[model samples]
Target: MARKASTRRRPRSGSSYRRVKKRSCYFCDSKISYVDYKDITLLRRYISDARAKIRGRRSTGNCQRHQNAVARAVKNAREMALLPYTNQ
Candidate 1:
């Protein structure tokens, strides 16, 4: 039987020394207890500029608690007209 090609990429020989840096939570480092909807500047950082969508925890590097708070704050801000519902 013929062998099928795998979807996964094979690592190049002798390039295994690369290390990924760990992401740290910004809110935890800054000692923030709550996310404020009225803080447009702060909220903007966690939003996608092109799509006006809430970024995921993996992308934003936010802890679980802070990510939840960020989601709520983004929703409230949008409802209050402080933030846009979409880029359009």
Candidate 2:
């Protein structure tokens, strides 16, 4: 089941990391309106290195619009055999 977007995960107990600052969207900064499915290098940055899953908005610092675009691009790339569905 998917967790609600409104609810946030609690910080780990006794962790060194504390509060995290919000990050600016990369697409907005670059002024890139379109996300290219063929851009493997660029798309790979948004994907998990180990699990091959898409990274959340918080992790990638992507805006909602761009994040959706990224996910679509990834799926297209996968269908084209340009990117592996899983790293393994």
Candidate 3:
């Protein structure tokens, strides 16, 4: 019988990581007219359990413009105490 080749290759500690794919802004593409900070349902997905901030495109798959909008919304929510600034 032929021996099978090794299937696993160990990763180098200093090796560069693979890049994540970008995602378009749902609101922008959908052409939504509003992003209400008081909309808890809309904001819930972006906020974590401890109320930590959501990641940008690099992590959350949001496009640049959409990410900016999300940031703005998050900030507004924070100011209104609708969203927590930090995990608590």
Of the candidates shown, which would achieve the greatest TM-score relative to the real structure? 1
* Predicted candidate 2 versus true structure: per-residue lDDT over 17-87, tens digit per residue: 67778999999999999999999999999999998999999999999999999999999999999999998
Q: Clashes in candidate 3: how many?
A: 0
Model 1, span 1-88: residue lDDT tens:
9999899987666677575676899999999998999999999999998999999988999989999999999999999999999897
Off by over 4 Å in 1: 1-16
In the range 4-74, model 3's lDDT, one tens digit per residue, is 99899976555485654576667777886677788877876776676486765666566667777777888
Show model 2 residue runs off by greater than 4 Å. Answer: 1-18
TM-scores for candidates 1 onward, in order? 0.80, 0.78, 0.59
Query: Residue 64 of candidate 1: its Cα lDDT?
Result: 95
- Candidate number of the best lDDT: 2
- Candidate 3 residues lying further than 4 Å off, grouped into runs, are 1-22
Q: Return the clash pairs for model 3, or none.
A: none
Clash numbers, per candidate: 0, 0, 0
Q: Alpha-carbon error at 74 in model 1, in Å?
A: 0.3
